[model samples]
Target: MALRAHVGKLRVHQAASEVAVESVSLARRFRGPGAAERGDQLVRAALSVTSNIAEACGRGSVAEFRQFLLYARGSAQEALSQLDIARRLEPPMLTTVIRRLESRSALVIKQLGRLHDNPPRQR
Candidate 1:
């Protein structure tokens, strides 16, 4: 099967993709001291979440997929931490965006956990 078709079947992949997009949007909005560096970290972590999920889908077995899901979950956590740090350091104007990203990251983590706990049977 095609890579996109395979990945499209997983709900976790969709959630992770949304988180990545939101992270990029949030990072673009960042400004002020240290904003650039923090934004870079946030974007990288967020992207990693989805990238790992995609890697999971491409793997040969359920165990391999679950392993990658763990990586994705860790990246999600990293992104969430970055969001929290950004919320503390950034101006009040960015609170809403940061909160939204945090919520999305949490969802991705939850979805990853579900997949990791009970991975689909390998075809």
Candidate 2:
């Protein structure tokens, strides 16, 4: 349950990677200093999902993978919350980008839930 475990060879699931990439791209497009700061947080949380999943997959048991996946899911939620705030605080120019990021976050959450329910090798 430690948060300091090594995350090696995360399988880079298609959905999760897409979310992470979109987040990073969105982070670079913010207009204001404040929005940029929040964007950094959003970016970090988005990237966390990728790392957490990789770490989970590296774990020794299905139970452990589930545990780390929970962490990843939490990060995804955190990113979503930050995105909502960014929507209000940011300028009007980034609306489409924000919407896309939100969509990706939602997708990551759904994918994480599915994987948690049926982890690899647990069938």
Candidate 3:
């Protein structure tokens, strides 16, 4: 739960910062472009991944956490899909950002799976 909460906060912080930086420029250049909606969708999807995990952790049940991890994993895939779309409409600079986020999301999913399979001892 602590790990998920911490990672969720990180994801939110990173995603918010990334959007804050690119949103203004993207809005100007792609105002009338389809990428506008896509960009927003991608950011929200990334947020959903972490948010759901955090919410689930608060439930204080291994089953609930596992379910939420599934949601988080799904959200990660959704974000990745939106990223692929965003790349076509945006600049190459976003490449590193997307890659880093993708890696983190993957790692989080793996960690969640490990937790589900082998829960830690409680004090």
| Regions more than 4 Å wrong, model 2 | 1-12
Candidate 1 or 3, higher TM-score? 1
Question: What's the count of clashing pairs in each model shown?
Answer: 0, 1, 0
- What TM-score would you give candidate 2 relative to the actual structure? 0.83
In Å, residue 14's CA in model 1 sits off its true spot by: 1.1
lDDT tens digits, residues 29-74, model 2? 7776686788799889888988888878677778888898999999
lDDT of 1 by residue, 1-123 (tens): 222226788888888888888888888888888889999999999999889988988887777788888998999999999999999988899999889878878887888888788776654
Once model 1 is optimally superposed onto the true structure by TM-score, how far is the C-alpha of residue 74 displaced, in angstroms? 0.5
Predicted structure 3: clash tally: 0
Better model by TM-score: candidate 2 vs candidate 3: 2
Most accurate candidate by TM-score: 1
- Score every model by TM-score: 0.91, 0.83, 0.63
